[model samples]
Target: MRKVIFYILISWWLVACNSSVISPEMVDECPPIYPDYVGVTIPATIAPMNFSCLDGEYERVDVTVTGGKSGEVHVNDKIVLFPQDEWQSLLKENQGDSLMFTVCIKKEGKWKQYRPFPMYVSSYPIDYGVVYRKIAPGFEVYSKMGIYERDLSTFEERPLLENTMVPGMCLNCHAFNKTNPDHMSIHIRGQHGATLMQIEGECELLDTKADSILSACVYPYWHPSGKYIAYSVNNTRQSFHAVKDERVEVLDLASDVVVYHPETHELLLSPLLQKKEVFETFPVFSSDGRKLYFCSAEAKPIPEAYKEIRYNLCSIDFNPEHGTFGDRVDTLIHAAAMKKSISFPRPSYDGKYIMYTLSDYGNFSIWHKEADLWLLNLQDGTKRPIEEVNSEDTESFHNWSSNSRWFVFSSRRGDGLYTRLYLACIDEDGRVSKPFLLPQENPWEYYDRSIYSYNVPEFTNMPVELERRKVERGIVSDKRIQVKVRQ
Candidate 1:
């Protein structure tokens, strides 16, 4: 009798579950979802992009994702949470194909099925992972900050370094040489400040603050050869605004650009870059390392004249063999004439195009609401804004992948406060596709509740292998290698 009762209970429970799944009314409108994954192109190696229904009237939601060739996934919830194994199997079998989603919602004792949508799966693969800084988008006072790397294939993040290791220190401007993990440069600001450089897996601390320079290194870019690094030293100050739309204004009192040779512990100073009348910053090297590009603007009175400051895109010939600069500087884009400022001039690895952030007037574009990404065709010198990839909110700090076919940028599109990472693809003809937000297991839950902002999103071909304890010890120690100015 006991065995028969147990079997009857099991049968009743199964019936309850199956009976709850009702037949849909077959609505014509499509279902509302967050992160807008519909009609977007996704990489096969990326994690499942979980999303939830935007319509609050629904009590329960069911999703059926069917691949073109082999696999299918059935999920039941208010949020579309996919199983990892099933998602992977579906993507693996349907590469260069499409996935169709059939969404059904339960509301007020009734079920409604919406029209299905499709998402294209790209045949091309993305990088291994990306490294970025997680910080609150605040001014002056930063509570906690760290640099972290995230694996694209999964939602695993590890810290390269954190302020908890050494209190009162802030890290920024983390860069790599052509996505090579063995070579990187990071700057730490505060009392124990130094430029930590990793060369061929060896880490060293360098005091970049030379007496001859006005200030320490602010922005950095590594040459393709990994022998030299270009940095900008700026005496910067910030002022608060009284207006409601704008909050803060950052101005450079004085600035100059210099190149540093790590092997010789020497700073390569050029008279053209160090001109007293001009403010130079955001230095970058061409793909072949034969040309150096930087932003320059005429010096103006601080705070009072900040609105008039605009940077023009300029390039100068670089002789990597002897670490010398050319005599003449060519103005690639006359941003000043157009009443605009340019920052973060990054050239693609293929040398076909250059990507930069254009704003109304200052170099610090993250704070500028009008900032957007613009691309320059190096072959034809034709420049235009990437409308497909830009948004109304601030779009700043972008980097290209190793193949130059994909790019990642920081945008505050979701909340207009915290920045998030977005990725887009560029074809051979320089046409940019629609950008999608970075995938999370539950994008709606994660982005809505998270307080941290993603900063300086850079793509890395491999994981950054650095021992945390060793790096912390080096940062806290007093031992510092002073860099010499090459006279």
Candidate 2:
């Protein structure tokens, strides 16, 4: 009803504008476009995959999209800008179908039609949007950065919190419990260093460092029940690479994993996870909350042996009922045996697959050019690289949608400096499709001169309910509840 009326308004507006349709000379080659939406499978609820011509001197673009169900949408402009309501209607009508795009452009007073392309629509739907950090690529300086959320259905992005809001503070390490915006945990560093969390609609500021803990919490993941959050306390250090195009090698001196319960303000410590001879980080809970997955490496001398640091995928039984851990640990994927490192191990909500980033040696994969996404089949214990989505550049920091049908990853594939977000679909039978870039009203306008890099992308079922006043109040109050170490 509302969509139909809005779509009608769009059609009437397009007709009223009286834009002249061009008859283009047919060309055999497809038009090279930015973001490359051609032949990629995307969720029906995604934003319009608008793109701009990359090669020619074009002043206007005209695209006609025809669905297999006979739904058609045409628009003419300098770039492809599909009507929001009409795009939604078209997608809803063409789920599990293909859309043929006939693109034409006017260049030098003549119109040319390129070879048509097909964009497949996946039957599965994505989350409401994604939440991620946008930060400048300054390795040594305190640059402006913020955590923002975007609506997948439209071109809208809003900041959950920014460093500017709390002056001189660095914001990072944010996590939500299984896409639930209500259960969120974000960290702030500076004079009022603390972790701001909202669990079950109750907000609290916590100073997670206890007397026994080595350092502050980093790389957090929420338990399924929303009662516990696993965090890695690390003594982190970094050094610059002398070679060109090399990034700051962020290395861990010492790290340990601990689980914190909000109700009792207790940090559960396990000697198996925090052994002095071992480095553990990036802990996440299984979908059923019965197991804890993390990355572990044998501790070596810092800086000199950093290249020898290889983390393997491991897990331990977790008793959510008693807030306890098992006596033994199991090595799931021995990445070190193959001279590879695993970082950011994320389990699917459906419990069928675990996606992780694999690099050569070090755990900091974002800077490792060989970093690629791999899928671990938990049911059969088979793991393989997601070949269809992997490129010649870095692909790290990935998360699955709540439905486990789609995944979002940050890649340094474009220009090899700034990380851009790309989404790919995986059907129930585990067929991964070619990844597509995050859409924008004018992608070229933004990506052409953007200086910020996308980081830590994760899907969310709803827009985060972070009240600016509440976060600001937490920053100003400088009060945090101290968590105690569990005996």
Candidate 3:
């Protein structure tokens, strides 16, 4: 009898161990995960999108990811932490396929399984990296800020320049020529303010403010030929709101658009872009460099009539060889007639579409909570909001990939305050997929703890390389090349 009882006890212990493996009891609702990665499309080269359960009831969790063409990954923890090597291998093997995840949680010694979800991995490859400014989303005062570049294929970020390098100064508006990091431009504001340009791997500091121009260059767009840069010189002002939803309002008291020729050190001014009654800003050169697109608004009274300001989308002809503007400006989209204002007119590299932000009023859509992305189809001249990638919160400052298959934009969708970078894929038919948050190793932890917002998220074909100490010395030194206006 004693021998029989010992054998029976050993068999019961074996059964208990097997039961702890993954014997889910009931089919419960889907597991609540941070970042809401469900049903989103992702690039195969992107980093692992680590997530955690928002519900704290689970004591233990198991996630089983099965790639359609690759092996399976089994992770056991309260939070899903994928192995980097295994995740990369899985994505490689399952490109242009789907990954299904089955999440099972243990609560009070009972296991429950949720409905499985799918994450499609697109075959379309994204840019190698992205560069943007990391600053506190605040009003007037700014603390420590820096321009950072992150590799999309991995979780690595390095600063190109920071405020600590030059104390009491602010750096912003970094632009690249056709996604070429070797040719870039950035602005520094403070006692030593100048536009820093890198051409073909050489750096030069220039004072873009000429005697005729209203103010220094604020918004910058490089010409495809690399000989010229289109800029907007604006007399900008700021105001604060007493309401809770609205905190600040930034408007241009006076503004105009101009092009700068680095080779000749001359600033090109068009009478149409610089008018007393009109405000023209946010100029961008077309992919072929034959036209310039900008935003135009009727000048209104200062902060008193700020809510009545609305900008219309307009374009003008450009002669790259002679660096001259056309005789007449053409109005593309009459945004004011539609009770909307447009800003940041970014044309795709393929020249098929132009994407801009549309708000109820004003050019500073970053502070406008109703701002969303609008796409203008150049082929049919039809425009519509990209509802697939927009949320109820603010969506501003977007850029397209070199191949025009992906776009990165900044949105205040996470917590409704800090702007985070998001990536979305676009098909040949101009259909945008649901956007996913810029993947982090630990998205929940990183996003929750971060205090800075990602502004001006732009894609780059290569990493931005700059000497930190050299840039600091150049900014501090009073050696600036003065730009002259073309007579």
Candidate 4:
């Protein structure tokens, strides 16, 4: 009855879509598409790269995807949509090659075909998903926010924990050891300020503030061995601008970097990183766990001299077994010499390069319109701006994929205010590719009405399994393990 009618309708729709497409008048130029997937390389496991015509006046769009492996898919509709199973199958069959895209659009009953483009398929596989913080695009107060995990293979996102668990709480950036969820850490700020630590699948809430430190743990990065976690504690303050171009400036009155020994419940101190005149933050363990990389800027007067604060890409030796730092600090890339600043120095897991954010001045590059991405070659010590992936807008808070062949970064490129997530590829020879926006089932509609901004995107090898009920109780109960041992 109804079931047979539904099946027959579906069959007819498919046939119509498959048979109704006609040869269109060829044009010389390419179609201007949203997301601009043109010439972008993607892994086989990524979600379908669905797109639509940027000019919405079109009556319909016809897309033909053809790969060198003798695979093809056609769609004729208002917006181009590919069948998920077929898209996956085609991508899998075309690894290490490219697929051609021929887009034709019908506007007011006439059909015209644009020049074809190519979508590269990389042989390298990406991580399972990414974990990030989603918060309202404001700095004064955090009304609602959460740490979420998204499966890259699909458009599925689930929140690990939301501020609703305990209202007025803020969830800062989360970190994992080599993309393994077994070792994770997140900083919670508010009345229930604490650091949630998970080591080898065991989770605990820790009051990470100590009398000797400037403040509670803020930014976190885990050592590969899981023996130590590096953090930067800062006495931070913010100021608003009266001018038109600038809005906010985050200046650290004082900051220092330290390492935490999970097994011993101790804080490893290093005076080298705690100099009174030097402000240090954004600590990360290097690829082999033998070095710790961080950002350092000469401390300046509060808000008056904030523009002079610039951080350099620096590193210090570390002994993972001993949970200790080297005596001397090295300035890997001194931005002050060039009158520029660097922040968020993320070294590739394969130890090939360090990608960082550069601005005119100040360590808080996210608020700087001049902020852009720069790459430092580890082997030769030469550095340059990543022009291919950078835009005229701010690019901040980037992370490397587990495979080191891909990277994800936060950019305010589209409209210069709403932060969006984009992913790009960098090959072994230091060649970079144009980045594509993070995929959505319907990107145009999703981004237009979005109020929240994506920040601190991190790749995870697998989905993070956390028990929200237990965590809510832990924070509500106000019980936390002190990082410093009891007297």
Candidate 5:
């Protein structure tokens, strides 16, 4: 009957996709995307023009300059000065002379001049991701701290989230992060103690009073609903039983405004193991925001270390209404059939399919061997290899487009240590097309030094805040809010 027809239809679609071939012309057709290059310049000193330089040159001399993202160096767009003239007004007042400026050509937005730093350099801006490190020795700029916006065409850095927040050393692991909608979070470590911050203009301290329940919060994930924010808190300061345990907590963003609102709380599940006893971490929400999926290792100290260092994907159904989660569980994948370790599970926007990377840690270099892409069906839980999309080369860090019809991921399959971003189309039948590399006109790509580790890719629809504002304004027509949280 109808059930048989559906099965037959699904089978035909799967066969057609497996036998399909992607062409090179498709790569040329992709629209160009440029990296937001932030150019800066700093003098050895910042005193008045007379004494600002070690040479003690010029009297009240006017050091004129201009800059900005568009390359237009107008009065307040992007410029810096030593004597504090009209350009100074455009800068974040009180900004030191070491301030960076941008002078955009009225025509192409090509930077006219970018003062070189005394000690360090910049990372290339590729589609997947970009990591910048400050080279100055006593320089306070954290390696992981930098202004990030969905579209930098009109971005302005806020002190709370950008400047006065992240500690220099902690930036790498607690790098700048953006959650669902307009919600942003950062792990701000200061002289008093470390606090898990969640805010847009400023870093709101989640554990300001130095609470003992958690030591430090990092690696935050925003629930799709934007009402909840979750992060892993360190418990190294506390005494442990035979079983070492860390806690993951969620905050009520709407009501958790105080230093630590009473409404805020942690999940009772403390690194629970599956029937086989494995440790789990790095949880992500499904498209429907019902299930929490993450990677798990064996339960032994380092416990559950995939003898091969391979991690399995697992999930826990969470019912937000009931405010509780079900038991720890594994997906239906034949765990033993995987070749290399499976890492970084990313569910598509439609919730119909999931994509992940497959590779061996020994061949950690993205250039050493290929990290193939695999797809799984959420309906019946059927899994298969994406043959045309993978190579003996490295391919990881996949992200979905706003429509779910397109996806962007990173791969060094044929390109050496050079991992670039690719855009692929997914059909209605759940078939993934060949990946097309991002075609920015420039040949200068952001090259990552960590051979084994490539940049992690994340995608979003529009600005995070705008989306949240729409929900608050009731402009969205979807009645999905009525959908119950899965338990």
Candidate 6:
């Protein structure tokens, strides 16, 4: 069989430092270049490491790979994921002696589970090596998962549970948080049995009045110091008729109390909170945890009037030292062009600018529908159109990377209806470059089908050394990964 062996640089070298195996440092060598953009070509008989089913039913087989490069690998049929049999493939070396190849599996006559798995071409000149890992069944269900390592070789699964929030509840705003290395938080609905669980080792309830206050909390921002979490809750009734036109409330983490719309608010008032008040939500706290930015709107009565969900971004002074949220809440940006809704306000790491989404709540279509990205300058409160980035279609649910150099947000620029992850580079002058879709072609393979979702992507700023150590020995100081509960 024709085999393609690839090489990995020493970049991924961490923990064990096995000179014989590829390390994490080699990861940078593999970029996600598409075939149309840049093709990869490998040279020589350098054999990349191999993987097969533990059953050992399929014997070791050799295949050669040619014309394959780091991000782009050419694999016709060697890469396969058959649960019943053993699978093996070869890696080839680039002219520079690097490793690169694509892997895939065939199931039910369809060529699926294909990914560009970057390999390390053994400069050691070894003919072959063994790759080992047990297959996780297709039945296991997951709530919210993020890509820690994106390239095929190092890309592994990591959970947001260390801080306790479900994927379904969070993907709307916070995809993942790089700021919090260990414990992560997610927004959940307390209305229909959905509760926010704190993920320390496992998901547990975060004991606070928030448990009883808002009907649902969508996006959560962790404080820079990791002491508190700021989130917004929808204070609407569970009735389908009531939710379509409910209001939002912002909550303070330190005291587990409702700061913006206190318990006295209309949503919390009557036999079912008989009295009524205005609605507010989408609370995003600055990195320093001093200012809390949110959106507020007057609640409407008609469901068809859902398009009336017009909320303008606003903020209040927050004092982390005394756990006191001061008054003086003011509106940052409110455009009548939104026709109604302005939500999901995300602040940059430096606290210089804010990005938010504008959409009509009535019709959620991306085509003729309109949703765009807007920026709010905190300096002089200047606002303008970011034409290079926003379009009439839809651009919402955005968050910044730790370095604040790149930001990830979901958009419907491609297939109108299907929302995909897009990464845009933030220039030094605060101008955002054109956005590109996430490299992973099938990142949304496992998600709810009916709704036009797939949002709240959180990026991690984990150190290179930390990821290297993880891939080498599969060991982490975090208790969640180390221990397993038996079924």
Where in model 4 is the C-alpha error above 4 Å?
Answer: 1-19, 485-487
Per-residue lDDT of candidate 5, residues 1-487 (tens digit): 9999999999999855433322211221211112222222211111111111111221111122333321112221211223333332433332332333222211122212223211101111112222221111222333433333333112121212333232332332232233233455544444423343334433233432233223344444556665454444332211112432211111111110111111343333333421234434445667777877765544333222323444566677766555455665656453434545565566776788878766653112233254677888899888877875676666766666555666666776534444665555566777554554442222123222222222444544434332333322221122221111121
Candidate 2 clashing pairs?
none
How many backbone overlaps does candidate 2 show? 0
Residue pairs in candidate 3 whose N, alpha carbon or C atoms collide under 3 angstroms:
none
Give stretches of model 2 more than 4 Å off: 1-23
Identify the runs in model 1 with alpha carbons over 4 angstroms from their true place.
1-21
Displacement of the residue 146 alpha carbon in candidate 3, Å: 0.7
Ten residues in sequence with the least summed lDDT for candidate 1:
15-24
Ten contiguous residues minimizing lDDT sum, candidate 4: 15-24
| Residue pairs in collision within model 1 | none
Q: Candidate 3, which segments miss by more than 4 Å at Cα?
A: 1-20
Best by lDDT: 2
Error of 4 at 374 (Å): 0.9
What is residue 320's positional error in candidate 3, in angstroms?
0.9
Encode model 2's per-residue lDDT on 1-487: one tens digit a residue.
Answer: 9999999999998765544555669999887888898899988988888888885677777899999886999988877889988998999999999999998887786778999999998899899999999998676666999999999989999998888887778889989999998899998888878999897678999888888988888899999999899999999888998988777788989999999998999999998998999999999999999999999999999888899999999999999999999999999999999999999999999999999999998888999899999999999999999999999999999999999999999999998988999999999899999999999889999898889999998899988887888888888799889889988
lDDT of 3 by residue, 45-153 (tens): 8888778877667777788899998878988776788998898888888999989988888888777888898888999998889999999755666587999999998
> Of models 4 and 6, which has the larger lDDT?
4
Q: Which digits, one per residue and each the tens of the lDDT, describe model 6 over residues 1-487?
A: 1232222333444322422222112222222322111122211231122332121232221222332343223323222222211111333224334443443233233322223343333222211111111112121232333323232222233432221222222222332233444545433232212323233334422222333454343445665655555555543322122352232222221111133221111111111111134455666778667877767665566444445556667667777665456645676666434475666677888778888776655212222246677777888888765676676567766777666666767776654555666656665577665554443322333222323344555655442112332321211221221111111
Instruction: Supply the global lDDT for candidate 3.
Output: 0.90
In terms of lDDT, which candidate is stronger, 3 or 4? 3
**What C-alpha lDDT do the candidate models reach, one value each?**
0.89, 0.91, 0.90, 0.88, 0.40, 0.42
Arranged by lDDT, best first: 2, 3, 1, 4, 6, 5
Per-candidate TM-score against the hidden true structure: 0.96, 0.95, 0.95, 0.95, 0.51, 0.53
lDDT of 4 by residue, 194-253 (tens): 899887778899998999889999889988888888999999888888999898888899
Each candidate: RMSD: 1.8, 5.0, 3.7, 2.9, 22.1, 14.9
